[model samples]
Target: MKVLVVEDERDISDSICQYLANEEFLCEAAYDYHSAMEKIHLYEYVCIILDITLPNGSGLDILKQLKDMQKAEGVIIISARNSLDDKIAGLKSGADDYLVKPFHLPELSARVAAIIRRRLFEGKNYITLDKLVLDIFKKTLKLDDIDIPLTRKEYELLLYFISNKNKVVTKESIVEHLWGSEMDLADSYNFIYSHIKNLRKKLIQAGSPDYIKVVYGMGYKFSIH
Candidate 1:
């Protein structure tokens, strides 16, 4: 999953990114309000770690923009102000969860995971489609009783495809979701084709139907029907 950390404190932001990265999440950091806005506008994240207090503007404003834009990315407010009012305001502004500054990294990670699970998997730990079963927490895919081994990138791609099943997903969006904002440095999207090819081969070999469909000049779609 991709996460954007909107924090002014360098130490806290770096710590969160490091911990989450170790847990296999792609993370990006924005120290101030303007940078945060730029990222939210440019990329899509599974979860956003937002601080209420920013250098030039309030994080609440960012939350408002997200709501106005109807972005589905989950938001978690991590603020030093632990007042009931702040928590209520954050929730009312569309934050899925709130965490105080002096919080443990593991708990924060768990909250982020839970939010992603609820948002993407409908609060379920596993997703079942046809004979295929995917364990979100375990990051494993199986065809009935047979296990299907996949690389990290393949697994992320599969999850993205499943989440948007039957919908056309552009290659640019796929790059942004998998690599975060760093995809700007990528030379080409040929790597996306490579990953898709491998994923298709594995699923086909595992006795699963070919659900991934190419959209010619546009992109790809995952359709079960």
Candidate 2:
């Protein structure tokens, strides 16, 4: 899953990213308020680890903006302050959870997982769609009791598709979700096409129906029908 760490302090931000990376999260960092705002506007993430203070603006303001946009991304506030007022204010401002700094990375990871579970997975580690079952914690997939191996990208793509099932997902959106800032380095979306093709083939080989459908000029849709 993708996560954004919006913290001005580079050392702390890097530490969070490194720890989360081991937990199978693709973490991206934003050093200051402007960059944080830009990233929140441009991309979507499973969860956002936001700092209370920033160089140019307040993270609470960013949280408010996100709520105003009706974005469903989960948010967890991390701050140096541990005052009851601060915690109450952050929760009132739409933060799903709050963490005081100088905390254990395991606790942070646990909190992040809790928020994601509550928001996206309904407190479960697996998601189901017909014959397919995706284990969120294990990062594994099964079709009709048969294990289906997936590359990390393929797994992410499948989860993305399942999360937005029956909706047309533009290739542009897929690229942004899968590659994030790295998309800037790509000359074309051939890699996306390649991944989807491989995923489709694997599912079919595993005796699963082709759930990924191309929508011609539009994009792809994953649906039972």
Give me the candidate number with maximum lDDT: 1
**What is the Å distance of residue 127 in model 2 from its true position?**
1.3
| lDDT (Cα, tens digit) per residue for candidate 2, span 189-224 | 888889999999999999889999999999999977
As a whole number from 0 to 100, the lDDT of residue 133 in candidate 1 is 96
lDDT of 1 by residue, 1-225 (tens): 899999999999999999999888999999999999999898889999999999999999999999999999999999999899999999999999999989999999999999999998889998999999999898899998799999999999999999999999999889887887776636648889899999999999999999999999999999996
Please identify model 1 stretches exceeding 4 Å from their true place: none
lDDT of all predictions: 0.94, 0.90
Pairs in steric clash, model 2: none
lDDT of 2 at 161: 91
Off by over 4 Å in 2: none
Q: What's model 2's overall lDDT?
A: 0.90
Worst 10 residues of 1 by lDDT: 179-188
Task: Flag clash pairs in model 1.
Answer: none
